[model samples]
Structure formats: C-alpha cells, structure tokens
Target: MRKKRRQRTILWCAIAAAIIIALLWTEQIALLYVLATLGLTILMLIVAFADLEGAKRSGQATDD
Candidate 1:
C-alpha cells in the first residue's frame, strides 16, 4: 500500500511539474521560482523509478 502511494505521488508530481514549467515558460514568473521548480522536477525524474521494496530486501536478514 505504501509503495503504491509513493508511485502515485511521483506521478502526480511529474504532471504538476510539467504544468508549472509550462506556465513559468509562457508567463513572466520569477526566475528563482522557475529554477526552484525545475530543480524539483529534475529531482522527481531522478527518483521516479526507484524501488522501495528492493531497498528493503537488501537490508533484511529474512525472506518473510
């Protein structure tokens, strides 16, 4: 359930980031705001495909 939530959050973030980027590019938004959001978008893309379950597997001593 938690993993699914994380995936959903990432998807929503990507969509929101795209919209924000579009608005920032077309509108006269502040440069700092654009850069901050772009940084967030890059961060979202970087960790979008990470596997939380896989990380747990490597740190555990038991399969069940």
Candidate 2:
C-alpha cells in the first residue's frame, strides 16, 4: 500500500510538471487555460498528499 501511494504521488507530480511545461510552451488564451488547469492539478495533488499523510498517521496510531 505504501509503495502504491508513493507511485501515485510521483505520477501526479509528473503530470503537474507536464501541465506546467505545456503551459509554458503555449501562448495567449491556451496558455491561460493550461495554467489554470495546472493550478488546479497542483491543488488537488496537495490535498491528496495531505490526505495520505493523515491516513498514515491514523494507521500508525492504530498500530500503537
């Protein structure tokens, strides 16, 4: 489970980086849209990481 979570986190980070790169490679309206999408993706990634950490903490507490 931890390995799976780590893989997913890396995947999301790569996706976010790709979005930012695409946004940088574009121009005008498309760039704006991509940037917005990238921002949302980053936000979601942060939320996911936070949730994962919280779950891990809870799991540890239960184990103890």
Candidate 3:
C-alpha cells in the first residue's frame, strides 16, 4: 500500500512535468497561473500521502 502511494506520487509528478514542459514549449505564458495552481495541488497531495503512510507505519508499530 505504501508502495502504491509512492508510485501514484511519482506518476503525478511525471505528469505535471510533462504538462509544464509542453506548456513552456508551446509558449503559453497566459496559462502559468493555471500551472501554478496545479503544481500546488500536486504538492499538497504528496504531503498528504506521505503523512498517511507515516501514520500507517506508526500505527502498525504500535499494534505490535
């Protein structure tokens, strides 16, 4: 499950990088605000997933 979360995060980051690259290649300066919003959203998701994984680990440890 933790591996799944990490894979998801990596997938999202790769997708974002591709999108940013495409946008920059196309010279779409007007859409930078949109990109910024997307970047922040991805960042938040990463942090959330990390926290969840950490909590799971701690929970499991306590269960033992």
TM-score of each candidate structure, all chains considered together:
0.43, 0.45, 0.54
Instruction: Assess each prediction's global lDDT (C-alpha) against the native.
Output: 0.84, 0.80, 0.85
- Tens digits of per-residue lDDT for model 1 on 1-64? 9999999999999997887788778885786487778889998987987887898889899866
Which candidate, 1 or 3, has the higher lDDT? 3
lDDT of 3 by residue, 1-64 (tens): 9999999999999988898889889999679778698879999999877778777787784553
Clashing residue pairs in candidate 1 (N, C-alpha, C atoms within 3 angstroms): none
Candidate 2: minimum summed lDDT over ten consecutive residues — where? 20-29
| Winner by lDDT | 3
Candidates 1 and 3: which is better by TM-score?
3
Error of 2 at 60 (Å): 16
Which is the winner by TM-score between candidate 1 and candidate 2?
2
lDDT of 3 at 17: 88
Tens digits of per-residue lDDT for model 2, 25-53: 77456777877888799999998778787
Model 2 stretches astray by more than 4 angstroms: 28-64
Error of 1 at 64 (Å): 4.7
By TM-score, the candidates rank as: 3, 2, 1
